[model samples]
Target: MCSLCGVLGCDDHWTSAIARPGIYTRNTDRLARRREAANRIRLANALLEPSRLKIAEWQGASYVLSSPTGRTQVFESLAHLWPEVEAMTARALDPLDPDFLERLKQRIEAAP
Candidate 1:
């Protein structure tokens, strides 16, 4: 149930809609989609951690981005993630910025 709407709802993002083997197909398995969502969250968190922020799956409908201080914003699309993150962290976050990419590369190299 959504904390705001108090109802179970799905706001499927387009990225998932275009996925191969189709989550919308009649025979699609729920577990596979769950795994994909979890994987996406894990990978994004790896990049987000340096900013002291995290994201959580919100009833499989929307994403809940949070700051270490507990501030949170719920968004239904990845398009909204950057602005919400920047608001929470008070820092501009550009995935394509060369300095940011260099930092990401260094983090990957340092990770186990």
Candidate 2:
């Protein structure tokens, strides 16, 4: 008898199938990737103010960030957007800084 039979009420069921090594590994990997992507988006969004930066999809998979002044930066992937968003957030908070625009440009250009 399976160790979890008592808690699950039966030994042969969906849980048993999922317990198989191959299925468990595949499912866990897929779920982990999804969770990581969600967390990345959440962190990026939290760092950027909606009014200052606008993120949009381009060519289905790429992303673009547009500023209030009409400046735009393109990123190959959502993962590449986080650094730009972080720089924009810093600039937004310190707009009067002497080299803010230069640093922001460098940040966007350096993004992958």
Candidate 3:
């Protein structure tokens, strides 16, 4: 009676081919995790936008910062990427923080 049941239960070659054991579920889970990570990154970047900072993935395990000047700085650790970016944005929001860029560079360089 369900729409999915009707389509999946139908005698169709396409459905049969894709309905293999564990294939659909495994792929769905992987895609869902990827989507969730992407969404988190998007939300975090949105928060950073007002501070003139943006975080982007440089490679699978690296993150890059896009500054207002169009300069890019790549950090080689995923573990410290978000925290460092958040810290930078927090400091950047304050007009008194003239050392934010230096601090960001130090933090990224120190990240393992």
Strongest candidate by TM-score:
1
lDDT of each: 0.73, 0.49, 0.51
Clashing pairs in 1: none
Candidate number that wins on TM-score, 1 or 2: 1
Which model scores highest in lDDT? 1
| Decoy 2 TM-score against native | 0.37
Error of 3 at 78 (Å): 4.4
- Give per-residue CA lDDT, model 2, range 1-112, as digits (tens): 1244211211222322353322322344544433444454454444354336777554333457878888788876454565676675553444455565565666567768
Best first by lDDT, ranked: 1, 3, 2
Give residue 57's error in model 2 in angstroms.
0.5
Cα TM-score per model: 0.75, 0.37, 0.45
For residues 14-39, what per-residue lDDT tens digits would candidate 1 score against the true structure? 56665454242232556665676678
**Candidate 3 residue-wise lDDT, 1-112, digit = tens:** 1354221222122322353342232234444434544564576576565467888754333567777777666765445655676565555254246565555556567758
